[model samples]
Target: MTAVAAGTALLLTGCGLGGAPATAPVDTGGKVEGTITFQTMQLSPTFDDYLNATIDAFEAKYPGTTVKWTDIPSNAAARKVSADAIAGTLPDVMDLDTGTLAPLGRKGLTVDMATAAGDVKDSYVATAWQSFAFGGTGAAALPWYLNTPVLISNKAVLGKAGLGSSPDPTGYDELLTRSAQIAKATGVAGFQPTETGFANSLLTVGVPLVDETATKAVVNTPEAVAFVTKLAELYRSGGIPKDSVSAKERSEIETFSEGKTAYLESGGSRLKIIKENSPAVFGSVAVGKPLGDAAKRTWVVAHGLAVPTKSGNLPTAVAFAKFLTSAENQLALAKVSSVFPSTTASLNDPFFAVGDGDLTAAARRIAATGLRDGRTTVKPPAADAEYGATLWSAVQPAILGDVAPAQALGDAEAKLTKILQERQK
Candidate 1:
């Protein structure tokens, strides 16, 4: 537990384990009053501002109780959550991206929400609701905000490469090849993102088809491995540069704005960041759906609220979680955060109505914003939770030429097997 800011009951923390729960009831004992801490994601200042505004509103709505928060950097939130739990206390609630929630749920750290949300549950989308189930066990989190990777390219670079229009959104392989030529000729970086298993992941984003339910390791399957291998080839051929590793997703937009890179894996949210940095380039940059290759899939990641088993204040905690996600707060969040909103309505709201400018055009053209299907599914692939570390670790070395893809994955396969066995115990 963290220190409550003098007098105000606010200190951030995290906790839990999981299991299947049939249903539960909402507590209506007036209002439970106590200090509750929330974990925030290290998105941008926009998310921070939105959190502050929501906390203020929740406090005003519920007297005698208060909310406090601690912002966790994206890279560190997972580690912090795990470490905090081992210490025997957790923030009453927290924000987490998709990849981190599963392992925690396996350890029984999160409260299942199916029963917790009750009658009002119908309000959320089916796909979003399904994300709460962990390894087919308990409900772990809620859908809050989502961002999709879009195909962002430089008009001048593309035009020079004979690609028509600004975004064109016509070809992925062609773009990769053309970008390589451009980089070789102009020395401008072709892509700001280095491929890990990401190129393969991008393929799925372009055409999403992963069957985690099979209890098989598909990442090493021909389709996925080949898709990823092609990306590795591109990286080796100077089609994608090493500097891409240093490019923060946020900075990738900046690199494009400054005309340093020709192609990028960015999204609708980057529009605000790009516009802020250079309005001229922002208008010129192309925004469209990721060009389909052999398949069609789109990728999205969301961060939202969750409560800990260890929190002493469940009533206040749930209230704050509910209040924070209510339409009012969600819209408030969309305005400040500038990322894609999670609510069906917030996403449909005219971007100008929510703030200023048009998001609908882009949303429709690219279908760039959508809830993650993997999150709320009633069932998930058995080893899905333990796959990340192995999958990525296996893929990374091969992508960097430290090991052959097959060999690296072999090592990872062993570790993956170990992790699963350990978790069972």
Candidate 2:
């Protein structure tokens, strides 16, 4: 899938239709003895062994309960979930993204995680838990794993450009300077920042998309205009890809994988693909801090599991969900894939801190520590997709040199303000 900005594709696990969270109260003293179907988001084959082992462990703990696991294709998963919701046949437990889960929560189809998870709640990272909890009504899903963005460098290419192996630019200004240097020497794009849209730029610089109350657009400040304008200048100077203004993640990924760019801001998970498809490039890989205007935060995304409020085996389903996200189970999954666990216990495991002195391990360690200070770049209203699209459309022209940055941002702010106001109604 084309990775947009950090927060555009978020999902929220939620309660049923009445704006009231559905209760999935744990029956700790009761017996769990029914079959519960657990649907996953395209996690089969690659994670088959680890998942099967986790399921086996859960079943062993509760002899009479059976977990019927199902894996859905990523493209079909959301639609299938929606269809199932309409038909009242959503699996007992299912994994969802923030975007898919948010609407479901608003409809109150999913049960509240606060009532479902028992004492196991304290084990999770507070931010991860709060993110799924929406408005602090308690989480509706258990954060399973995270994918945080990191700065990756092709050392060989960067060395040719006179930049260090692990280049750490302080902000967009330094980023542009370094990128222009690389582009001048190598004749390739210098920095392939995740032009997932305007949000990506704003959030990386510690600028909130909206004001504290989220009622109006606050991105028209002088700092914002300068940032956006600089990006356009970088584009013009060949510091970024020519198509960057309209480029999606695939283009950036392709450019970086083919070593056409010196620096890439991508999720830590991309390391696996590079290792497999571009071994030569992988050998010279270097991990560095995420480039931004701020020091404390970066962009992060996660995958989590949620349960339907109408499940026939509520207790068993909730129990299994907890089991799947348990520190041990999460670690098991992390051991096999590029995923990083969300649980504090899992993160504290020695394996996470132990690096083998290689770029892959170094990147993973940087990402793991960064997740502690990370957040979704933007948290748009429920009508985020519509408004986000509008905002991006309005701003792209400026970034592409079609309009002045201040004018384009002003136009986007006006449209977004109206959109937010209308959505509140």
For lDDT, the strongest prediction is: 2
TM-score of each: 0.71, 0.84
Residue ranges of candidate 2 with Cα displaced over 4 Å? 1-29, 165-167, 194-198, 210-223, 246-250, 292-294, 372-391, 413-425
lDDT of 1 by residue, 136-243 (tens): 434566657655556676777666655545345445566666767776777666775433225334345332223443223434455555555655676776666555
Question: Among these predicted structures, which one has the highest TM-score?
Answer: 2
Each candidate: what lDDT? 0.55, 0.69
Decoy 1 TM-score against native:
0.71
